[model samples]
Target chain A: MESKIRVLVGKPGLDGHDRGAKVVARAFRDAGMEVIYSGLHRTPEEIARMAVDEDVAVVALSILSGAHGSLVPAVIEGLRQDGADDVLVLVGGIIPKADVPALEQAGVSRVFGPGTPLETIVAYTKSHVRRR
Target chain B: MDERYLTLSGIPIKNCYRPDDTRQLDYARDLADPGNYPFTRGIHRDMYRGRRWTMRQFSGFATAQESNERYRYLLKQGQTGLSVAFDMPTIMGYDSDHPKARSEVGLLGVAIDSLADMEILFSQIPLDEVSTSMTINAPAAVLLAMYIAVGEKQGVASQRLAGTIQNDILKEYIAQNSYIFPPEPSLRIITDILSYCAKEVPRWNTISISGYHIREAGSTAVQELAFTLADGMAYVEAGIARGLAVDDFAPRLSFFFNAHNDLFEEVAKYRAARRIWARVMKEKYGAKDPRSWRLRFHTQTAGCSLTAQQPENNIVRTTVQALAAVLGGTQSLHTNSMDEAWALPGEKAVTIALRTQQILAEESGVAQAADPLGGSYLVEALTDEMERLAQEYFDKIDRLGGVVSAIEKGFFQQEIADASYHYQNRVDKDEYVVVGVNRYQMEENVEIPLLSVGQESVRQQWKRLERVRSERDGQEVRRMLEDLKECAQSDANLMPVILDAVRSFATLGEIMGTLRSVFGEYREPARF
Candidate 1:
C-alpha cells in the first residue's frame, strides 16, 4: 500500500477571499492526499508554524489581496526560520505573471494563477514533494 | 462528442424554449404586473422610466485621504452614490497598526481605524446630500456608528441619513468567512442593529442580506438564491425573537446579489428571488405591509468571471453582466473593472467600468420598459424552475433545523463545494467554454499598470492612528467600551452603546476587542 502525501492549505494575511483555498483543498482531498486546511485570517507565522507542526510534505498558501509580494515571502522566511525548508511551498490565487519569478526566487516551488486546473496542482504536488 | 447543455446550476436546458415551456406559469399570479404582489416582472412599476438604476461604483483603496479623492472623482463623473470598501484589517476589526494588520493595511480597500479616519473618508461629501453603502461586516456596528457620528458632525440627523451596511454576517459564515464572533452572538448583534435602526435610522438599510459573496464563492445560481434567502429568513426570525415587529425592520431590509455571465439565467434568478421573498414574507412570516415583501437588491458584476489571459475581454463580459442586471431590474449596480483579474482596478479601468453602466442606461434601449424580457418563453420557464429548485433547498434546510444548525453541520458549504467542483470539471473537459480562459488562447503580455498601495500610506495611517489614540480622553474611551461590553452581556440593544463608543473616539479594534471578551471568537469547522 502506498503512503498518502500530506498537504496543508493556508490562507495567509487578512484577505477573506477563500473560495480558491477551499476549492483547492477539496481537490487535494479528492486526489487521496491528507489535507489540512488552515482557516482564514492566519498570519504568516501561524501558517508556517502549523506547517512545521503538521510535518506536512507541502504547504500551499493562497492569497488574493495583492499583498502577495510581502505576505508570500514572509511565509517562506518563517518556514526557513523554523528549519522546515524542505516543505515545498506553492502559492496560488490571482498572481500576476510578472510576479512569478520574484516569488520563485523567494523560495516558492510553484505559483498557480486563476483558471489553473486543479489536476495540475495535484500532479505538481505528487511529483515535487520530497519524501522524508 | 456527446451532447451537453445545462445551466451553471445543473439545470438541463432544452434544445429550444417556446410558449409551451411556460404554460404552467400563471400570468396574474406568478407573472403579475410590475410592482404588484408576487413581483416577478419587477418591484417598481415604472422601473428605469421613472428613474434609472443608481450607478453605484464600489471603490476604495490605500489611505482614507486617497480613497476620498477617488470617491470625489467618481461622484464628479456622474456617479450617483458612494460605496465604501474598507481594507482587510478594518473589516476584520483590527486597528491599522496591529501586528496582524501588517502588509495588509490599505491593500484591498481603505484603512479606517477610528472616527477620525471615517470623517476623512467622507470629509467634503455631505452626509445629507449623498447616500453611502459600506461593505463591512464583523465590525459593521462599529462602522455604522462611525458613519452616524460623521452624519451628526455634518448636522444631519440619524433619521435623515440614507445608506446601507452590508451587516449580513450569516453569509460571512456560509461563504465569505470574515466573521469575528461565533454564530449565535453574531446573529444577536445583527438583530440589535435591525431593532435600533428601526427607530434611529429609519431610512437606512439595516442589513443587506447578501447572495453576492455566496455566488462568488462558487455556489450555483439556485444555491446563491436559496442560501441567501435562508439567511434572510434567519435574520427575520432573530428580529422577531427579539420582540421587534416584522414590518418595522422588514421594510428596510434589502438584498445584494451577483450578476454573472449568463444573460437569461441571471435575469430569471432575480425575478425568482422577488417572487419567493414575497410569498415567504406574506405566507410564513405574515408580513402585512406590501413594502415588507419587496426584495430590493444591489447587483455587482461577477469578479470571478474576469480572466487574466486577455483582460480586455472583461470589458465585454462586464457590459453583458451589467445589461443583465439592468434588465433584471436591480435597484443599483456595480460593474467590475476589466483589470480586476490582475489587481485592484486602476483609475482609467474603473472609469471605464462605471461608463459601462452609463452607456447601458443612457444609450441602450433595454430599460425602456419594466421586465423587457418578461414574457419570453425561456425566461419565464427558467424563473419558475429557479423558484422550484430554491423551494426544494428550503425544505432540506428546514429539515436540518434551519440555517444555523445546517451551518453547524456544514450543509451549505458542502453543497457549494460540490457545485463548484462540478463546474470546474466541465471547464476542464471543455464542455463549458469560457472565452480567453479554457479556449481562444492568447499569448500576449499584460501591460496594464496595476494599482499599488505604497508603504508611505501604511506609515501615514499608523501615525494617524497613534495620534488619535494619544489625543483622545483615555477615561472616556474606557468607560464607553465598558458600557459596550455590558450591553453585549445583557439582552439590551448594542447600537446606542456602540454609538457612544464611536463618539468617544474609541478605535474599531478597542470596541470589537471588548465584544470579543464577552462573545469570544469563532473558528469555522474544517469541512474539506
Candidate 2:
C-alpha cells in the first residue's frame, strides 16, 4: 500500500494565535497529507512525544509570539534526545531574517517567514518527507 | 472592460440604479429612522455629530506594570477608552511561572495570571473614571471577576463601571483556538456571565460577538458577517434557554468586527450585519427594547493584512481600513501598528497607528455624517446581496443545530478552511495583489527595525509569579480552588467562585485545572 505523507502541525508554547497554523494544516490536507494538529499550548516535549508516537515524517512548528529562540531549540533537542532525528523539522511564523541562520543551525530544515505561500510550504514538505 | 461588468456583491454591474431598483426599499416600512427599529443606516441619528466614535486603542505588552504604563500613556494622549490585550499565557489562563509560560511570560500582549496581575494592570488608573474593554474570551469569566475585584479595591460600586468583555466563545471554536471547555459547558459559562452581568455589572456589555478573528482567519467579508451573526444568535439562544429575559440582557449585548484591506466589501458587511442583527433580534427573539435590536459594534483593522516586508506600507493599509470602519458606522476602532507583523508594536509604530485614526477623524471628511455611503448604488446593492447570502448561512447553521453543533461537526471550521485555501490559491497564482508580498518584490532587503522581546523579560516574569505565590496564603488558595471545583459541578454562576479563587491568590492554571476536571478538555475532530 502506498503511504501518505504524515505531518504533525503544532502551535508550541503559550502563543494562542493559531490562524496561520490552522490555515497551514488545511493547506497540507488539501495537498494530500495526513495532518495531525496539536492544538494550542503544547509543550515541546508533548509535540516530540506525539511525533514519535504517531510516527510522523515531518514536524511543523508555528510560533508567532517571538519565542522562537527558546521554543525551536527545545523541540530540536527533544527530538534528538528521543532518537527521532530523522524527522524533518520545519519552523514558520513571524521569524526575523537574522534568526533564520541560527534556526537552521539548530536543525530546522527550513524557516518560512511571513507572506510565504501555502503552496511553497506544501511543496517543501512533499519533497523533503518523500526523500526522508 | 466596462465597469458595468462588475456588480457590488458579484452581481452584474448595472448602467444605473433607478427607482425600480429601490422599489422594495420603502422608507417608512423597510427603512426605519436612525436609532429606531431596524437600525440599518446608523444606530443613532446624531452618530459622530453628537460625539466621534470612541478611540479605544488595544494596547498591552510585557508585564502588567509595563502595560499599565502604556495604558496611562494612551489615556493621557486623549484616548477615549481603554482596551486591554492580555499576553498569550494570560489569555490561555497560565500564570507567569507555569512551566508552559516559559519564554512567553509577557510576549505578544500583557500578562495577567491572577487577580494580583490584574491589580497591577490597573494599579494607578482609576477604575471609576475609565471604562475598560478586555479582549479575553475563554477565561473571560475569570478576567471579569478580577476586574470587579479591582473596582472593589478602589471602593467603587460594580454598577458604576461600564465596558465590554469579548466573552463570545463560539468564535473561539471557529476562528480562534483559545477555548477552554467543550461547547455545551462553554455556553453554560457564557450564559452564566450574561445572567450575572445583567444584575451585578448592570452597565457592562456581556458578550462582544466577534467577526474580528473570523476575518483574520482569511474569511471573506460575507462569510465573516454570516458566521458572526450565527455565533451571536447562538448566544441569544443560550441566554433564552437559561430562562433569562430577552429584554433584560439583550440591551447590553455588543459586537466586535474586523476592517480588512477590502474597503467596500467591509463597509457593505458592517451595514448588512446591523440590518440582519436588528431583524433577528426583533422577529426571531421577540426583543422589545430598541437598544436590544441595535447592533452596536467595535472595529479593529486587520492584523493579518499587515506585512513585515515593507512595514511602512501598513500605515496606508490601516488608514484605508480605518476609513471604511468609520464610514460603516463603527462604535469604536483600533488601528493596527505597522510593526505588529514582526512583534509587539514599538512606541513609534503605535503612535503612527493612533495618528492614522486622528488623520481620518480630523483631516479625512469621511465622518462628517452617519453612514456616508448610505445611498450609494454599488454599496446598497452590495449590502442587499450580502444580507441574502448571510441569511442563507444562518439557515444552514440552524439546520446543523446552531453554532455549537456546527463547531463539533467542524462545519464552521471547514468553511473557513475552504475560504482560506481559496485565498492562498489566489495569492499563489498571482490573481490577488499584495503590495510588498507578491506584486512589489524587491531584490534588496528592506531596512526596518523589528521589535523583539528579550529573554530577560521572561525571566523577570517567572520571578514575579514566584514571589506572588510565596507571599500569599497557600491554605487559602487550596480552599478557593476547592470551592471553584464544587461550583463547576453545581449550577452556580462561576464568576463569584472564580473571584474568590483569584482573591485567594490562586494561579490561573490552578483555577483552569480545577474546572477542567469537570468540563474536560475539548478534543477537535480530525479533518480529512
Candidate 3:
C-alpha cells in the first residue's frame, strides 16, 4: 500500500481571487495527493488550526490581496506555536519579487507567482515532502 | 505535435470559414445594422467614428489622498474618466481600523471607511464634470450612497451624475468570493439599487454585470459571456418581481467584459454578447425602449494574461487586448499596466498603459469603422458559434432554476474550476504557449521598480478613520444604524436607510455589521 501525501491549501485574509489556489489544489488532487482546501477569508489562526487538525505534510497559503507581508508570517508563526512546525509551508499568488526573500526568511519554502507551471509546484512539493 | 485548432472555449475551429458556415445566420434578424435591434454589427451606428470609447484606466492605491492625486494626474494626462479600485478591506466592507483590515488597508486599492474617505477621494475633481466607476460589490449600496452624498456636496445634482457602480453580486459567488450577504438578500440589495437609481439618480448606471472577474478566474470567453448574461437576466427578473417596470431600470443596466489574448475570439464574444442581450431584452422581457436593449459595456485588458517574466512583453499584450476591445466596440476601455503582474503599477508603466489606448484610438485607424471585423467570414462564424454555445449554457442554467439557484448548487463554480484546471494542465504539459514563460524563456532578472505602499499610509488611514469616528455626531449615527437594521429586517428597500446612514457618516463596517446582524453572513458550500 502506498502512503499518500496530504496537503492543506488555505486562503487567508480578505483576498477573494482564488483561481491560482483552486488550480493548484486540482493539480495536487490529480497528482494523487490528499488535499484539503481552506475556503476564502480564513484567518491565519484558522488556517494553522486546520493544518494541525488535518495533520497534513504541507500547508500551502495562497493570497493575492498583497497582505502576504503581514499574513504569511502570522500563519507560519501560528503553525509554529501550534506545534506543527514540522509541516512544510508553501506560498503562491500575486506576491512581488522583492517580498519573496522576506517570506522565505519567515519560513515559506517556495513562493509561486503568475505564470508558474503547476508541474514545477508539484515537483517541488514532492521533493520537499520526500526529504522530510 | 498533432495540429489541433479550437477556440479557448473548446469550440473546434475550421481551417477556413466560408459563407456556408454562416448560412443559418440571417443578416436582417441576426446580423442587423449597427445600433438597430438585435445589434450584432455594433451597438452604436457611429461607434468610435463619432466619439472614441472613453479611455478610463482603473487606478487606486494607498491612501485616498494619494489615489486622488493619481486620478487628477491621469485626468491631466488625457484620461477621459475615472474608475476607482477599492482595497480588499473596502471591498469586504471592513473599516480601516478593524483588526481584520490591518495590513490590507489600501494595499490592493484605496480604502474608504466612510463618507469622509469618499469626500477626500473626489476632492478637487468636480463631480459633475467627470464620470466615475467604482469596482465595489457586497456593500455597493453604501458606496453608491456615499457617491451620491459626495455629488450633492459638490453642488452636483443626483440626476447629473454619470457613472457606474459594479453592483453585480452574482459573479461574487461564481468567480470572486468577496460577498458579504447571502444570495437572497444580495439580490434584494441589487434590486433596490436598480429601483432607486432609476428614480433618483436617473443618469447613473446602477450595475455593471461583470464578466471580467469571471475570465480572470480562468473561465473561457464563452463562459464569461454566458454566466454574465445569465446573471443579468437574474437581476432583471428580480427587479420585475419587485414590481419595477423592465424598461424603467433596464436602460440604466450596463455590462463589463475582459479582453483576453485571443483577439478574434474576444471580438466575437463581444459581438455575440450584444446580439444576445438585445434579443433577450426585446423578445423575452418585451422592452420597448431601444436604450434598454443596447448592451453598452466597459472592457479591461486581461490582468491574468500579463506576465511577470520579461514584464515588458505585457505592454504588447495589453495593446493587443485593448485593440481587440476597440475593434469589438467597447464603450470604454482600461488597459492594464505591465507591472500589474508583480505589484500595483508604477507611474511610468501606468502612463504607458494609458498611452496604449490613446495610440490605438488616435494613431491606429481601427476605431474609424464600426466593427472592423464584422463581416469577416471567420469572425462572423465564431460569433454565431459563441452565441449558440452561450444559449446552450443559458438553457442549462434555466433548467437548474435560474442563476441564483444554480450558484447555490455550485454549477458555475464547478465549471470555472474545471476550465481553470484544464488551462493550467495545458500550460503544464507545454501544450499552450505563453511567451516569455513556457516559451522564449529568459534568465534576465526583473529590474522594474515596484510600487510599495508605505506603513505611514496605513497609520494615516487609521488615524483618519479614528478622527471621523470622533468627529461625527454619535447620536445621529446610532439612530441611522438602528433604522437601517430595522429596515433590513423587512422587505422595505434598504437603500434609503443605507443612504441615510452614509449621510450620517456611519462607517462602512458599522453599516455592513448592522445588515449582517439582519441578513447573516454567507458561508460558501464546499465546491470540491
Candidate 4:
C-alpha cells in the first residue's frame, strides 16, 4: 500500500482561535494521514521549517484572526525559499471569497471556510496530495 | 421502526417527559425559592422585574474615536452597559505598529495602546454611571490599570468604578489560546488582581471565569459547566492559597457562559451550574458569605451556532438561545448579531440583535418569572442529570490533579477536540442538522451589508502610539516599567505598579513586554 499522506496543519500569526485547526487536524488523522500540528502563534519561518523537517507532502494553514492577508503569503514565500515549493498548500478559516483567487495564485491548492464538512476536506486531500 | 431524539450535545432525549421523571426532586434542598440558598431557581427573588438583566452588547472595532461613536450609538439605542472587544493585536499585548500585528490592527476589535487611548475610548462617558466590561485577558491587569487611571482622570476614583475584566487565563490556555505566560505566572497575576480588586476596585468583578469559549470550542453543555466550575474552583483555591480570605474575593468572581441552540439542555446546564457552585462554595470551601455562594453570570448567544449561509436564520437562532438564557436565569445577556458568522455585525444587524432582547423583555414576557422553566419535568430531570454528568468530569479532572495539571496534560484540549470532531461528523452524515448548512436547501447570494473594517485605523492607531511614545515622560515610563518588572519578579501584587505605569503613559506592550521577559512566554505543545 502507498504510504499515508503526510500533512502538517499550521496556525500562523497571532490568531489563537484554533477550533478549526484542531477539528480539521483530527479529521485529517481519521482519514489516515500522518498529521503534524503547528501549535498556536507559530511564525511563517517556524511553520515552513517544520513542513520541511517533517518531510510532509502537504501543509494546511488555519487562521481565524484576520491576519491571513499577510501571514499566508509569508509562509508560501518561506516554503519557496527553503526549496519546498512543490508541497501542496491549503488554507482554511474565515477567508473571504474575494481573497481566494490571490491565495490560489500564491500556490494554495484550496481554501475552506466555516461549515465545510470534514469528509470534503479529507477526500480533497487524498485526491490531491503528492505523496513522497 | 424507531426514531432517535438528541440534543445538540448528543444527549439522548425521551419522546415525552413526565412528572415521574423528577419525582424525587426536593423543593427545599434541590429547588429552593429564588434568592435562597442553593439558588437553582434564580439568584434574585424577582428576576428582571425588580432589576432587568443588563443589555451589554459587545462592540468595538477600528480606532478609539470611531469605536466611541459606536458605543454612544449602542447606548442611545438603549444598551445598558458597555463591553469593549479589543483587537487581536491588543488582545495579544502588542502595539498597533508592532510588525507581528501587521494587517491585523483594528480588524475585529478596537486597538487601545495606552491611557490616552482609554481616555478617548471612554471620553464623554462617565465611568461611575456606565458600568463597562472589557473582554480582555493575558494583559488584563494592564488594561484594568489603564481603566482605573482613566477613572482617576475623570475624577472617578477606583472605588467607584464597576465592571468585569475577563481576567480568566485558564480558559485562554484551554480554548481561546491568546495566553502569554505559562499557567503558573498567569495564575499568580490573576491572584494579584483578585487581591488588588478586593481592596481598590471593590465594585469591580475581578474575574469572569468563562465557559463561553469552551462551548464555542465545541464542548457539550455538561462539559462546559464542569470545566468552567473547575476553573472557578481553581481560582478560589489560588486566592485561598495566597492567604486571602475566601469571602474577600470570592463574591466578586463572576462567570460568562454561552447560550447555544440546545434550549432545554442549555437551561439545564445553567440551572446545574448554580446548584453546583453554591454547594461547592458553602460546603467544600467553607465560604460563609451568601454572596460567595450565589452564582452570578452573563450569557452571550453562541457565535458558533450562527451560520455564514442564510445569515437571516441566525436571528431566529439567537432568539431561541436568548430565551434559553432568560429562562435559565442569567444576570445579563448579549444577543449575537445575525451577520456575525460572516463579519462583525453591521449597524442594522446589531440593532436587530439588541431589539431581539428588547422584544423578549417587553413583548414575550419570558423574563417575568425568576425561573420560567423551573417547574418543567424535563428541565428538572435534565438539571439533575447535568450535575451527575458534570460530576463524572470533576472526578477525572481531580484525578488529573486539578485544572492546571489537566491543561498541562492536554486533557481538556483533547476532550474538546474529540467532542467537536464528533459533532461535525454527525452533521456531515445527516445524523444531526444545522439549519442553513445541512437541512435547508438554499442557493444563497448573501448580500448582508458587512461591517467592512479598513486599514485607516491601523494608520490612526500607529500615529497615536507614536505621539504617546514621544510626548510621554520617557524617564518616568522607563522607571515605572523597571519598578513593574521588579514587582512581577516578587510576590507583591502587580496591580498597584501597573496602575503607576499606566499613569506614566507606559503602553500596554511595554508593560506586558516587561513581565514577559521575567515570566517567559507559554508555548503549548501541539498534538492531534
Candidate 5:
C-alpha cells in the first residue's frame, strides 16, 4: 500500500485532557506518519471502526481518566471484531507500571508512560510498522 | 552566561528589578483600580478579604448516584461549590449503551444521559442554594438544558440558577478535540446558549472561556494568554453576529485558567489576562457593562506538572500552584491530588487535595488582601512583557484569519509541538530538573498506595446503561431523534431540539452521531 502511515490515537473514556495525545499525534506527523487523531471521549468500538476504515497500521490509545483497565481490553475486542487484529496497539498516558503485563495480554503491543520520549515512539513506529 | 536560572517557562529572572524596570507601567492609567477598570489588580475590592475563593473541587465517578454521594461528602468537608466532571461517554455525547460507550459509560466523569441522570447527580443538593459548575462543552447546551430540566422539577426558577459551563469549544480543536459539531456550528450553539441564558438563566455563566488546558498542553504563559484571548475574541464576534449586545452577555462570560509551576509567570499571566480582556471588551466590542469587562476565572492546579517518579512531590507542586492561583485572585479553584500522576484520585488523596485548599484559605494569610503582589516591580514588568508577547501572537493569528484558521493551518498545534519538544529535550539533556524523574534519583520501594477505580465500576455502569436503554420509550426516542435531525438541517438552533432528545431519553452517541453525519469528522492538519 503506497500511502501515508495511518495511526488512530484516541481517548477511550471521560479523560478530557488530550494534551499528551495531541502532542503525540503532532510528533508522529512530524516524523512523517499519516496520523488520524480522534478527539476525546472515544469508545473502543468507534476507534476500532476508524482504524479499520482508515486502514491504519497502528492504533495508539491514550486514557488518563484511569479507566484504562476496562477501556484497553474493549479496544482490543473492537479491533478483533473489525478484523483489525493485525494493527499494532500502542497504549499510553497515566498507566500504572503494574498494569503493563495485563494490558499486553489484552493485546496492547506496547505501553508508554509520562517520561517516554517522542523520538523513541517514532523509532518504534518506523521499525515495527509493516510496510506493504 | 548562565540561562539556567530562568523561570520554568524560560522567563529570565533578574538579580533585582527596581523602579526602572517598571517605569513604563503607569499603575493609575494602565492597571487602574483593583476592582475598577481593567481589573488588573483584582476583580473585587475586598476579594479574599470579604469572602475566600470558593474551594470547588471537581468530583465525579461511575453512575450518578455514586457521584452524588461523593459530591455530598465533599460538601460536608467544607467545599463551597460543586464542579461536575462528566464521564467520557457523556462528554462525547454518547449514551451509556452506545457501542462506543461499552466499557466507558461512567469510567472517568459522571455518566449523564438524560434528566434522570442529571437529577440523580444533583439529588438532595439544593439547586437554588448552591452554585454548580459543569465542565462540559460541545453538547453544553444539551447538558445545560438537562440541568434546567432538573431545576424545573425541583421548583427552582431558572433565574435562581447560578453556575458556569465550560462552553469554550475552540480549545477542543486546539488541545482537547472532544467536540461534536464543526467549528462554525459549535460557535453558533455557544452563542445561542449565551443569548438564551442572558434572558432565562440570568445568573448563570454561559461560558468559561479557558486557557487552562492550553497551558497544560505545553504552551508557555504568553501562548496560553494569546491563544485564549484570541478564542475569546472569536466568541465576542460570534455573539455580536447573533445580534446580541456585547454588554448583555459579556458580564456572564467567565474564564478558567491553569496555574502551572512557574509562580511569578503564572501570576503575571493572570494579571495580563484581566487587563487585556477588559481593554478588548471595551475598545474592541464596545461594551459598557463593568461586569462584562471583569474577567472572573476559576483556577485548577496543573496536572501535567505532577511527576510519576516521586509522586509525593506533587503535593508540593500543587501547593505552589494553588497559592499562585490565590495570589492571582481566582474566584474558585481545584487542586490536583498527589496521586493524580498515578490514576484517578481516591478518597484519601482527594481529601488531601481539598485540605490543601482549605489550609490555604484558613491558615495562610495570602488571602488577606486583594492582589497583594500587585505593586511588585518584577510582577508588573513580567505582566507587561507577557502582554506584549501575547499581542504579537494575536496579530499573527489575526493575519492567519482567526482561531479556526489557526487550527486549520496547525498554527497552535505546531507551537505546542515545538514547546513540548523543547521541554522534553531539556529533560533528556538533564538541563531541566524534574526531581526524582531525572534528578535526585532515589533507590527505594514504593510506599504510597496507587488508587484504581476497579473493574466493578465498569460492570455496574454497563448494567445501568442497558437498563436505561431497554426501559425508555423507544418510539418517543425515535421521534425525538428525527425531530433533532430536522432541526439540525434547518436554520433553527439545535439547543431546543437537543433538549427534546435528552428529555425523550435519546442517548449522547445518537445525538453526536447525527451531527457527525452532518458535519463530518475533522481531519487534523499535518503539523510535523
Candidate 6:
C-alpha cells in the first residue's frame, strides 16, 4: 500500500483569520491525508522549510489579509531556493479573480475562495497531488 | 414542500408550540419588568421607545487623512457612533515600516504609527461630542492613550471622554490570535486599565468583554456565550486578585456579541446572557451596585454568515440580523456590509450597511415595545435552554481550573476547531444550505466594485511616519519608553506611563515593542 499523502497547511503573515485554515486542516485529515498545520503568524521561510522538512506533497496556504500578492510569491520562491519547487502549492482565502492568473503563473496550482465546497478541494488535491 | 428541521445550534425543533412549553417560567424570578432586577426582558424599561440603539459602522482604511474623510462622510450620513478598525500591522503591534508590516499597511483599516496619525484620523471630529469604539486589543492601553492625547488636543478632558476600548485580551489568546504578550502580563495590563479608567476616564468603558470574535471564529452560539462569560469571570477574578473592589470597576465593564442567522436563537442568546451576567455579578461576586449587575453589550452581525457568491443577497441577511439585534436589545449595533466577505467595505457598501440600521429604527415598529417576544412560548423555552447549556459550559470550564488553564491547555482552541470542522462538513454535504452558495446557485460572477488598497496607501503611511520621526523630540520619546519598560518590569500601574509615552510622541510600535521585550511574545502550539 502507498504511504499516506502528507500535506502541510500554513497560515502566512500576521493574518489571524484562521477559520478556513483550521477547517481545511480537519477536512484534509477527514480525507485520510496526513496534515501538518504551521499554526499562526508563520513567516514564508518557516512554512517553506516545514514543507521541505516534512517531505509533504502539498503546501497549502491560507491568507485573508490581502497580502497574498506578496506573501504567496515569497513562499513559492522560498521553496525554489530549497530545491523543493516540485511541491504542489495551493492557495486559499480572499483572493481576487483578477489576481488568479498571475498567482497561477507564479507556480500556484490552484486558488480557492470562500464558500468553495470542501469536497472540491479534497478531490482536487487527490487528483492533482504531484507524484513522487 | 420545504424540509424543515433544526436551528443553527443543532437544536431540534418541533412542528408546533404551546403555552405548555414555557409553563415552568416564573415572571418574577426568571424575568421582571424591563428595567427591573435580573433584566431578562431588557435592560431599559422603554427600550427603543426612549432612545434608539446607536448605529455604529466599523470602518477604517487607507491613510489617516483618507480614513478621516470616510468618518466625516459617515457622520454626515447620520451614523450615530464611530467604530475604528485598525490595520493588520497596527493590530499586531508593529510599525508600518516594519518588515512584517510591508504588504499589510492600510489594506484593511487605518494605519496609525504615533499620536500624529491618531490626530489626523480623528481630525475635525470632536472626541467629546460623539462616542467612539476602538476595536483594539493586546495593545489597547497604547491606543487608548493615543485617543486620550487626541482628546487633549481637542481641549477635551479625560473625564469627558466616553468610549470603549476592546481591551479583552483573553479572547485574543483564545480566538483572534492577535495577542502580543503572554496571558499573565496581558491580564495585568487589563486590570490596571480597569482601575485607572475607573478614576480618570470615568465614563469610558474599560474593557468590552467580547464574544464577537469567538462567534466569528465559528463556535456555536452557546460556546460563544459560555467562553465569553467564562473569560469575563476570569477578568473579574483578576481584578479582585489585584485588590480592586468589584463594584468600583465592574460597573464600567461591558460586553460585545455577534448576531448570527438564527433569529429566535440569537435573541434568546442575548436574553440568557443578561440574566446570567446579572446573577453572577450580584450573587457570585457579592456586588451591591445594580449598575455593576447589568450586562451592557454591543452587537455586530456575524461576518462569517455573509456569502461572497451572491453579494446582493447579503442585504436581506443583514436585515434579518439587524432585526434580531434590535429585538434582542443590543445597546449599539454594526451590520456587516455586503462586500465584507471579500474585502474591507467600500463607501457605497458601508453606506448601505448604515442605512440598514436607520430603516430599522425609523420604519420598523418592532422597537415600539420593550421585549415584544418576552412571554412567547418558543422564545422563552429557547432562552431557558440557552441558559442551561451555558451553565454546563461554565461548570466544565471551572472544573478545568478556569479559562486561563483551559487556554494554556489549548482546550478552547480544540473545541472551536472541532465545531468549525463540523460546520464545514455540514456545508460540504449540503445538509446546511447557504443560499447562493449551496442552494440558490448563481453562475454569473459578481461585478460590484470592491475596495482594494494598492501600495500607494502604504507609501502614504510611510511618509507620515517619516515626518513624525523627523519632527518629534527623539530624546523625550526614548525617556517615556524607558519609563514604560520600567513599569512593565515592576508592579506599578502601566497606564500613566503609557499616557506619558503617548504625550511624548512615542509611537505605538515603540511602546508595544518595549512591553514585548519585557513581557515576551506568545507562539501558539502547532496542534491542528
**DockQ, Cα level, model 4:** 0.72
Query: Which 10 successive residues of model 1 chain A have the least lDDT summed?
Result: A14-23
Q: Candidate 1 vs candidate 2: which has greater TM-score?
A: 1
True interface contacts reproduced by each model, as a fraction? Answer: 0.78, 0.70, 0.78, 0.70, 0.53, 0.80
* Tens-digit lDDT string for candidate 2 (B1-528): 553354222335566666566656766555566665677788999888888998889988887888889999998888889999888777877677767776777777887877777888999888888989999988888888889988999998889888899988889888787887898898999999999988899999999999999878767778889999988888898899999999988989899999987677788889888898999899999998888889999999999889888888999999999999999999999999988887778778888889888888998888887888877777777778888899899889889987888889989877876777677767778766789899987766666676666667667677777888899999999999988888989998888888888878788878877888889877665332
**Residue A66 miss distance in model 2 (angstroms):** 1.9
CAPRI-style docking class of model 4 based on DockQ = medium
In candidate 5, stretches whose alpha carbon ends up further than 4 angstroms from where it belongs are A1-18, A21-61, A65-67, A70-90, A107-110, A117-132, B447-451, B454-456, B466-476, B517-520, B526-528
Report the C-alpha lDDT of model 6 over B1-528, residue by residue, as the tens digit. Answer: 233577887777677779999888899999999988799988888888888898899989878888899999999999889999999899999999998888888887889999999999999999989999998999899899999999999999999999999999999878889998889999999999999999999999999999999998989999999999999989999999999999999999999999999999999999999999999999999999999889999999999999899988898899999999999999999999998887888889988988889888888888899998899888999899999999999999889888989898888888888788888878878888999999989687777788888778789889889888889999998888888888899999999999999988888888899999999998775445
Candidate 6 accuracy as TM-score:
0.99
lDDT per residue for candidate 4 within B1-528, as digits (tens), equals 232487788777888899899999999999999998899998989878899999999999999999999999999999999999999889999988887776788888999999999999999999999999999999999999999998998899999999999999999988888999999999999999999999899999999999999999988898899999999999999999999999999999999999999899999999999999999999999999999999999999999999988889999999999999999999899999988877788999999999999999999988877898888999999999999999999999999999999999999988888898888888889888888898885997878787767777678788999999999999999999999989988989888899999999999899989999999999885645
Give the number of the best model, judged by DockQ: 6
**What's model 2's overall lDDT?**
0.84
Clashes of each: 0, 1, 0, 0, 9, 0
Tens-digit lDDT string for candidate 4 (A1-132)? 888889999999887888889889888988888899988888898999999999899999998776777888999999999999989999999877777898898889999989999889989988888766
User: How close to the true structure is residue A2 of candidate 3, measured as C-alpha lDDT?
Assistant: 63
Task: Rate residue B498 of model 3 by lDDT.
Answer: 92
Model 1, C-alpha of B323: deviation from truth (Å): 1.1
Query: lDDT tens string, model 3, B59-142?
Result: 899999999999999999999999999999999999988888897999889999999999999999999999999999999999
Chain B TM per candidate, please?
0.99, 0.96, 0.99, 0.99, 0.97, 0.98
Full candidate order by DockQ, most accurate first = 6, 3, 1, 4, 2, 5
Model 3 docking grade: medium
Model 2, C-alpha of B230: deviation from truth (Å): 1.2
| Model 5 chain A lowest lDDT segment of ten | A11-20
- Residue pairs of candidate 3 with colliding backbone atoms: none
lDDT of 1 by residue, B73-144 (tens): 999999999999989989999998888887889988999999999999999999999999999889998999
